[model samples]
Target: KDFKSEEEKREYMLYLDGSNSWILKPLNFIYNLNDKAFFLNSDHTFEDAGTTIEIIRRAFENSKNIRKSDVNSKAILIKEFVDEKNAKKIKEEKEKYLKLSAKFSCNDLHLELKNEDCQKFSKDSIMQLIMIYAQYKTYGKFNSVYEAVDMREYEFGRTECVRPLSVEAVDFVKLLDKFEDKQEIQDALEIANNEHKNRIKSAKKAQGVDRHLFGLKQMIQKADDKTKKDALEFFNSMGYEKLSQNFISTTCTGTLDFIGYLLFTPVVWEGLGVTYLKTNDEVIYLISYHEKQKENAKNFAKYLNEGVEKFKKIYS
Candidate 1:
């Protein structure tokens, strides 16, 4: 059944207040009558994307061929895996002043590139190149880049941030903008890819700079007043400001068979959030941006496609 109007759709969906207390509990199944879509909403405080995906897969397997009425009766019990005290601490640490904003719009792009074009490079490297080039073409300059790195190999771990804009990456994107020689661009790409791989390795080992600095800042809050003041001053410096902007936030979920797409709002109003899934022959991306922002998701997707085509020619 379709919703008669937007108001009816909102009335049918589960609405939460500003507190978002409902998110603290178990999973929530929200159905949108307008799009006839179902969404599983979970808090990041409890489960990360990897665990959530596994839960969804299990629920899907259990519900296969089952009656619609019986589906609700099938309970998927998750264990008490999260440490309560730690979870509470994490939740408390996240409390901040709220500034409301308008909703962001997203565009989805599914592109199929010839395997040979990307065969020489890692999927992640290629994606990173395409993203950097797209950003340059869209905004005419480089910005801080963030790629989510899963840290679940460690106990009670969630994710760490990998800043992908290395000196080599910057050089490569510059060369890309200038239409440099194919050999020069290819060499720069390899160097950038290597740097990206190193960053991923460091983040996976929980040695990334972001989390360590975050933890240090949290510790500073409990330090002596003078120490805390000094630390806060440095944290508020322009150097830190630029690092924290994260104008290009991207995450690649790899080729998850169950996931058709992923969407997330940009961390900043003027930034872009990109989530991509790469399969054997195709790469699918969901690019999100605030409507008020100068950059358009549709236009960014166009630049991304152009970058892909450029890569095809370079490799050929």
Candidate 2:
């Protein structure tokens, strides 16, 4: 309900102070009709001091909601005066509070209408100022304004921080070996073919080309020298050689890390040697960077050790 007058406002203030619903308590004491103001007028309650009958009586006269019958039940809650002018100041401050709240609301709507660009958001705008003012008003503690701003900022920060996952080095080899099993190899090949076909279809539809070779080439060009060197080293470590000419390299999308996975496929096969090579029969390792999937690497290594222990599998 709207605070219509000074007494109504005072009642609301008392209500806020006495209630524990808000994060911070607002009032410290309750006064009755007749009491000498003590300790900023908040040192004693009506129960502790019997002399508050007059003050309560005046408050009741000014308040419309204070029924003659309920006066005995609801005594006035009092708080320490930050200053004698505080009640009047708070009364006046309500005007500014309402204005700020309204402006903040408008700002929220405007920001939503505008393009979603953090850099473009006005630094001194009402929305930004409202958040800052709210923080200052609450002194870093809980308040309605502060809580609202915190939630908005938290969501924006989370969106900005989110990124796609990327594969790591150790599992690169294990994925290849996993495909060595006939059934697993067949399933992996099907998945790879599906992906390849989808990509080819997308590329052809978009650019009228069966092979998006130009796009892959652009990715190879965009790669930093360090990334290229690291990629070559990774490939060599897996017994794969760099293509004499990076033919399909010019066309690619997505992050360099994802592209690196695609690029690493040939290297894995090459590193294993010419004996494993087949014409037009490419292999794609089903690699995941999921932390949980890494347990499979340990299991695979254990299986390799067991096989060697049983058959004494010789190294080349």
Candidate 3:
């Protein structure tokens, strides 16, 4: 072994070529160390991926005292008995969410609303109103809209759910145009605030319109053929559910005060993504669509800024 010099041992290895490799065995589990990557399971439901993760975290990690036995149970929130009415509603909403799948892209917007302005107009309600306004200004109308609700306040199972708010937002936007005075603006804000609060209350108790509708869908699915057919027919007749995205989904996420650098990237390598995150001093809005829709996303950012500034001036 010592017959040749050290230089001769390396003679066959010229330039340390990385061109050759051989596999001796395979491994079962996979490990990924790349921080730049994100993922969404192909089998997941149509709910926004970011919201889904936050929901799981709240139900399991945040709430330490949740009942382990109720892990997989569904709520009988409204009309415990399954009927044609409930099935139709669920099918209609579910169909709307599924049919409106767009492309994948992303944009981050940084903005600040002072504490004083937030007192007069609720942040959630105002942000929601602004979205509707921007959509109307751009697309003229949106048949259906989505608002993700947190249902963790109730003493239920560990699995969390979101309430899909089906509202006449286009009609509401029309009403906004008729407001000529401060009284009218105040009235509008009041009504929107009330609706927002009511949605949250209903969602917490499991009586949320969407959650109940979901329960109904499950019940009707287990029923006879005639029932299922009837529900489908009724759902199809509703034009609102059929109309795809003139609008998109929205949600508000929490942030830390001390952490200077933070990343809340969720995997949406294929479709759309949107999330609202806030620290003590600022709010960051992230919206994403497919690469081809970059122009639309850019315009939306402009619309959002204009909407916010206008709202600020209206009641100022």
Q: Which prediction has the highest lDDT against the true structure?
A: 1
**Compared with the true structure, what per-residue lDDT tens digits does model 3 show for residues 1-316?**
2214422222211111111211101111111233322222222233333444554456546457767685665734443454798768765754553344322334568776665665554566666776666656655555244556665445652222332223533444555655467666666666666676666666666665555555666688787999999876655565524432224656665553222222222233322345666544555667756556566667767777776666655567
Angstrom error of the Cα, residue 38, model 2: value is 99
Model 2 per-residue lDDT tens digits across residues 1-45: 344453333333322332232222322433323332211122222
Q: lDDT by residue for model 1 over 66-102, one digit each (tens)?
A: 8877557565665555589877865564342122323
- Which candidate leads in TM-score? 1
Instruction: Answer with 2 or 3, whichever has the higher lDDT.
Output: 3
Model 1, stretches more than 4 Å misplaced?
A: 1-26, 31-37, 61-102
- Candidate with more favorable, higher lDDT: 1 or 3: 1
Q: How do all the candidates rank in terms of lDDT, highest first?
A: 1, 3, 2
lDDT of 1: 0.73
Candidate 1 global Cα RMSD: 7.3
Model 2 lDDT at residue 274: 7
Q: By TM-score, how accurate is candidate 1?
A: 0.77
Give the higher-TM-score candidate: 1 or 2. Answer: 1
Task: After superposing candidate 3 on the true structure, give the runs of residues whose Cα lies further than 4 Å from its correct spot.
Answer: 1-103, 154-172, 175-180, 239-247, 257-272, 278-281
Ranking by TM-score: 1, 3, 2
How do the predictions measure up, each by TM-score? 0.77, 0.15, 0.59
Which should have the higher lDDT, number 1 or number 2?
1
